[model samples]
Target: MEEKLIELVADVLEAEPGALSLDTEFKTDEFDWDSMKGYAILVTLEDEFGASITVDDFIAAKRVGDLLGLVSE
Candidate 1:
């Protein structure tokens, strides 16, 4: 799941596949993860994991690990 998460995030952000890690912070220029991208991420997560994510969930997430937690839940 982590591998898939990494791949999806990297693809969405147009980042190198090997560049991001679990501890990678989303609130940075390196990730280029603005709110619009964040919404895209939520959409991807719902489609990928068949899970519903809320705006609160998106707002509370500060890192890739938090996204993992969201999907896992």
Candidate 2:
């Protein structure tokens, strides 16, 4: 899930996968991340992990690990 989420972050933010890590703050670490990117990640996460995520949940996420935690929950 970590690897897949890293790849999705890169795809949505147009970043290099190598630039991200398990602890990467997906929202703040990247200059280009926006609400739209958050939305994209929400949908992709649902598709990939079968997790039900809300806007508030996505907005509450501060890091990539938050996402992993969310889906795992």
Candidate 3:
């Protein structure tokens, strides 16, 4: 599950899959994540995980790990 989540985030962020860690910040300076990419991520996660995530979830998610935790719940 963690591996799949990491791949999804890395694909969306255009980063090397191996470069992403659970602690990586989605909106940090090192990553170029923007609002558009963020929404894309939300949609992708919902579709892939069969989960319904609200806009508030995206708004509150500060990192890929945050989203992972949300969907896992």
Candidate 4:
């Protein structure tokens, strides 16, 4: 799930798969993470994992690991 999530995020953010880690912070200048990208990620996650991610949940996820937890939950 971690690897898949990383790849999903990378794809959504147009980043290299090797660039993301669980601890990596989102919305940083390192990645082209903006509101649109965030929404895309959330929608993708919901589609991929069958999890309902709220906007508040996405905003609360400060890092990749947090997103992992949300989906896993």
Per-candidate TM equals 0.91, 0.86, 0.88, 0.94
The 10-residue segment with the lowest total lDDT in model 1 = 26-35
**Model 4 per-residue lDDT tens digits across residues 13-33:** 888989889998978878856
Q: Is candidate 2 or candidate 3 better by lDDT?
A: 3
At residue 52, what lDDT does model 1 achieve?
Answer: 87
lDDT of 3 by residue, 1-73 (tens): 8889989988988889999888778776677768888888888888889878888877988766888887787
Clashes of each: 0, 0, 0, 0
The runs of at least 3 residues in candidate 3 whose Cα sits more than 4 Å from the true structure, single-residue gaps closed, are: none
lDDT of 2 by residue, 6-58 (tens): 89877887888998887888886444777787888888889888989877877
lDDT of 3 at 16: 94
Worst ten in a row by lDDT for model 2: 26-35
Best-performing candidate as measured by TM-score: 4
Tens-digit lDDT track of model 1 for 1-73:
9999988887888888788888888668887658788878889988999988888988988888889988989
Ranked candidates (TM-score, high to low):
4, 1, 3, 2
